[model samples]
Target chain A: MIKANKIEKTYSKTAILTPVLNDITLSIQKGEYVAIMGTSGSGKSTLMYILGCLDKPTKGELELDGVDVYGMDDDALSALRNKKIGFVFQQFFLLERTTALDNVLLPLIYANKYPDDALQRGRKVLAQVGLEDRVEYLANELSGGQQQRVAIARALINDPDVIFADEPTGNLDSQSTAEILDILGHLHQEGRTIIIVTHDRTVANHAQRILELKDGRIAEIKNP
Target chain B: MTRTIRIARESVRMMGRNKFRVFIMMLGIAVGVASLTLMMCVSKGAYERVMDTVNRQGPDLLQIRPGTDIQTGLPSGSREVVSLIEEDVSAILQHVGNIRAAAPVKDRKEIEVIYEDKFTLTRIFGVIPVWAQIRDFGPREGEFISEEDISFAARMCLIGQTVKKNLFGDLEPIGRTIRINNVPFTIKGELQWKGISSAGRDRDNRIVIPITTYTRRLFRDMHLTQIVITVEDTKKLNKTIKDVRTVLRDQHKITSGEPDDFAMRTPQDLIDLAYGTSRSLINLLTGIAAVSLLVAGIVIMNVMLASIAARKSEIGIRRAVGARKNDILKQFLIEGLIVSLFGGLMGMFLGMGGSVILSSLDVTASKITPLAIAAAILTCGLIAVVFGIFPAKKAANQNPIDTLKV
Candidate 1:
């Protein structure tokens, strides 16, 4: 679960400031499926990054599982990202020359648990994502759909409590996008908390709740 | 099983993959080691050649000549008619603890040694029978004159190979009649050729006769020219020389304030001085070689820095995946160490081979001390680590996000 209150972020030394996220507060409980939807430059990705502990908010009270994430050091933030959160990128960001299994094992490198069991868990996650036969294949050799599944397997490698996906199917075709949506739906049914950042209405429609951002602030919250 | 080992293996594999670079690096080290080894071999060979020529005279052998005063630029009045009689030689033999043997020698120049119609002007040496053993003189034919020959003043002479060639030619000189200074004497033995001394004096061009015959019959009651003393052991040569000087001064009744009439020398002293000079020369050559090795280390460091720069993306990926700073540092350091280790091994093989080849070619064989090899390896290893630090630190300190951006 992630909680942020009055979050603000800015870049550069310009007095004419462009805020990526401004005075916005939100909290997501465990086992909830939520979507943040916005057009380009509307700050949805920035909000997702802050929520994932990848970037610190300029001014905010942010907590994850009752621990003050905003007050944590860089190593602690990395640890939180490793143990408590998983990220699935839109572009599938798989290491280009490495096998799908190796790409999936990347997240567990930071995990404190037994790495052998984590590798076994990664294989299981790949099987769950319908990439069991393609685990040994490289990212460039796999179809776009399969690469996204490998990224999903990588995000699930550490068995994180929450999965944050940013435009998870933006680069996929209709068939591949449908498969990714079905995988997300299955994960939500398994009682895993999920937050997706996207511009597509069809992708947001699958979520239990949707938050729309406009010009660095949350415009509206719609319960599905 | 450790991650560090895995990283080291990976680094070695990478070095192997870049064969040309590794070869260039190794070439640098090899050239340095080879030059060092060769220099040491040649210098040591020349030194030993000189030493062998000197030692062939005898162990504990010393040549005492009158010393010249440096400030006056003239021969010092240090040469005294020390008058080394047979009794003096006996006293040194009996009283000096470390003296193995002693003999008094008188060199008579421009002496005509004639046998049949053949005649030659040669240097004649009047010496005791122990002089043959002390000077390592071996007879090619017949036998050396005995002590009884010297006591009875028998006119028996040992002719050197050159003397036999000039005075007797193709005929055997043993028992042949020879005239020294027109005085009749029988040739008792023929000395084998001993080439030349390091001082460029021909050792094979002299005739030796009994000291009693030369002192009484040739140079009547003359002062002895030189006293040759051979010590029992080289380690105690200085002590023996000191004791001999003390006894001679006491016999001559020289007061404590005046300089003694005799001079003493030791073969070990000459050997030590020669070896010391040679060692310094070897060290100088090795020091120059070390500079080149240091330059090679710098080259390796530069190449490693380039490698780190080129592999920035790969490093970024590893760091992003939770590799600690020390892990990255270790990886780069291992790469440097692998390069240097390979270079060091190749250099050792090449250096030893070169030394063998040089020795086979009649050059003085090089002594490859374990200390030298250990020093070379340790220096290479240390250079690798020292030069690797900056590049490794650079690689380790890279920000993953900035690196991943491009």
Candidate 2:
């Protein structure tokens, strides 16, 4: 479960204040698959970032599983991000010049919990993303679609409770996009909560419910 | 993998990514450490050499030389002033408690000697029979001078290797006669070949004659230039020195607080002086080398800072995964230590090789010790930590959100 109360994010430039996200409240139940749809400058990406714990909200009271995340320090927040949440950026932010298996193993490395079967765990995650044969391929050597799958496998390495995907299929072909959606649907069927932020209508259609954002505010919610 | 091993592995991987830069940084540290190590070797080698030479003269040996201010007991002013007299030698032998043997020495340099058709310039030492026992020198063949030779002012002398080579060539010179200052003297024996003395001066290039013969036949002077004393017991050296000084002061009729115009030096004193001189020389050279090491440390810092800049994206990715700021800090610091340690090891080999080459050339003695190498490596590690912390801290403090955005 996730909750945000009156979240606000602002950027200051030369003594001028600019608000990227205005006061808004939202909550999502466990196992819910939701999509936030917005055009450029609509603050959907900003909301996703705050919810993913990548950045703190300027004014907010965010709670995850009844724990106040904003009240914790940077180290504790990083640990929470490691064990609970996974993120996939639009650009497939996998480490370049490294093998896909190593990319997936990144979270395990930082978590300092390399089980005796850590390598096997990494391999299994890559297999789930349909990259079992490309585990040893470097990011640069892989196709765009393959790289995105590798990034997804990395996000799933920690077995997070919630997956946050920001335009996961933005740079993929239609065939690759369908494959990614099928993987997401399978993950959602496993009872894991999923949230997707995208400007593409077809991508939003894959979610169980949709929320439309406009000008830094949530305008409408629909079950589609 | 263990946390430390993982961090070290990552650090090594980063260095491998920038091999040329790492190499340059290591070269800088190596040169600095090499020079420092070389300085230590040279100083140690020179000190040991001097100790060897001084020890040859025996440990409890003492020499009383003129114009060495009695106040400080050090050589002072002009040594041309011969203040010690023959009476001081006799008085010291009589009054000193730990007396072994005493000899009065008078020497003149560049003295011309002629033998048949050959002639050469050499030093002449006029000493009593006891001088042989006091200075650790005796006839290599035949015999040294005797009291009878001094009592009658006998025209008998002992020739050193150099003197014998010049005056007799291959012929035996034991009974040969040579003229010194137009006076005839027979060579009673040949002194041994003692290669070189302090300061690389020839040790076997002089002739020894009786003190009476020297004063009566050659340069007529009653004042002795030096009084060589050998103490019987090592523990009584100081007491013997004080007793000798007391006799000389009393013979000169000087009251308390007046300079004795003479100074006593033991072999240990010379050893200390030699060691101090070498230590200062080593310090000066090492100080110069340390400046370059400081520059190298700065260069390491600059390279690490540049690396942080170049790896911003990687840093952000790691942070997003779960790495804390402390992890980033530790990674960079370990990288610095690895670089410095490698450089230091190479530098140690470089310095050791240099010392070996230098020693072989016989320019100056050089010795490498294990302790010095360890010290140099430890210093390199310290330099790495000192210079590596700033950039590492900067990297650690970088905000993940900002870095990710970029």
Candidate 3:
């Protein structure tokens, strides 16, 4: 469901160009649970961002679910993201002042065909993540583990096919990290393709396949 | 729900979070709209006042008072020279065209009048019987000063309603004798109720006597105070005034270089004089309203720009959640529009309250009309749209990736 052909990303300053991702090529099938692992400067986050359709590569082609991603305009690109992809960040990235239910329902705002039962759908997702009682709690008022759970619910709101978890447990305690991995594992079992980016080996072992990056290139690929 | 209302609800929630910023925005627009409302109120009130004066004095009536230097257009005070007389009245009537009727009048205030044991200080007007026709007033009881009264110089008088109330109480005043300046004169008529004059004085507080009797018996002066003339063609007053001026100048033998020894006045002149100060005041308010709105618009722009800059994270998050650039634009624009609309209403109420107090104090007159309300709202809308664009555009153009990374 996801493919990249020779993807390259570079940052150009006044007179210097620094490469962030170089000659990246990969593919993942439907319902696949994959993990990209790297150290701080290994460009694993950059690769995940590219795969998540949040950024365009300077030189490459990307296809998500048979659609040429970069060829579309900004509006179409945004619509594609809302319909087919969900992102869970290290910071959780929930709107700070709003309730967990409001954050869970965020993706539906841009869904084009807003469901008549959008609130009910949001509540169902929150309940799926063991947050039925925390739905009315504000994001700032939630614990780190609970905030991550709310974000996971937000990702599931639009029922997207591809889920990207970039350092999803980076800021959480060990218990919260385990909770997030379990939720991602459940989503994968439900036929959603799951991609996790992390620097830790323990987290990578949870994925069915692991791709390790070094100096902006794929150095090793192994099945766990 | 419609897109506008949805965006407005979100915008309102955002604005409600910052109380002081919203207040500052509201204050500027409120002051500007308040001044705009006040300007309209005063102008409308002043116009109505001038028309009232014109209606009361009779549109076709003009007066020639014994004054030469009436540079201010007032027919009294130090400019009066007492050079006009009964003969000049005849000359102008016979010579000036468009003469409907003419009457000579001499008046004196603060005369002690006695009726039995009751006495009051009253004003006395010495006028011919034709004064009744010229002034469009006549006694409701008894008779006006007649031709015989003018020819014989009889000591006959007409008492006004105020005089009757003061001296006679419920007693009948017609045919009763009253002592004016120690001279006994029979009250031949009781005048009708004329209400209050435009000058804020009681109109029915004086007595009218024959001009012949007034000149010989009471005033002891051959010179008349004024000649009241009603023109046949109301539209031809200017030309008639010019003709009368020429006749007076020729009869008095005043050279072209010398100013005439009499002053002319018309209802139109009174209207013009009444508006002189009010027109300038209205213009000053217009300038204030314009400048206030301009400054307020600029302030709104600067505040909005600063707010958009500070709200970068919020903008990015909204964009990330599927909001289009145009959606952000609509949101902020709706926010400013709501603020301005409320500010305008607040200002309107404040202005109305202010006008009521000012009018009650007998200062400048003011009335809030429908046009004033419409103008206030329209101006607020225009200012909001004009000043709200840059900030909304900046907000819409914010990059979700860059902001989210921070």
lDDT of each: 0.75, 0.84, 0.85
In terms of DockQ, the best-performing candidate is 2
RMSD vs true structure, all candidates? 6.9, 4.2, 4.3
- Model 3 stretches with alpha carbons more than 4 Å out: A1-64, A69-71, A194-224, B2-5, B12-39, B68-75, B78-80, B83-102, B116-120, B133-137, B194-202, B230-260, B272-307, B360-364
- What TM-score does model 3 achieve against the real structure? 0.82
Give the per-residue lDDT of model 1 (tens digit) for B366-396.
6555655676677678877888788899988
- DockQ values, each candidate: 0.17, 0.53, 0.34
Q: For residues A1-224, could you state the per-residue lDDT of candidate 1 as single tens digits?
A: 77889999886558777788889899888999999999977888878878887777889899898888888876676667777777787767776667899788875554544365756787899999998888789788999989999988888877788898989898999999999999999999999999999999889999999999988888656875
Least accurate 10 contiguous residues by lDDT in model 3 chain B: B71-80
What is the DockQ ranking, best to worst? 2, 3, 1
Order of candidate numbers by TM-score, starting with the best: 2, 3, 1
Which digits, one per residue and each the tens of the lDDT, describe model 2 over residues B148-232?
9989999999999999888888999999899998899999999988887654568788999999999998989777777898888
**Per-chain TM-score, chain A, candidate 1:** 0.96
Q: Is the docking of candidate 1 incorrect, acceptable, medium or high quality?
A: incorrect
* Chain A TM-score of each candidate structure, as shown: 0.96, 0.96, 0.97
- Report chain B TM per candidate: 0.79, 0.86, 0.86
Q: Point out where model 1 deviates above 4 Å.
A: A2-224, B13-59, B69-100, B107-124, B136-142, B159-187, B190-207, B212-226, B232-265, B272-281, B361-364
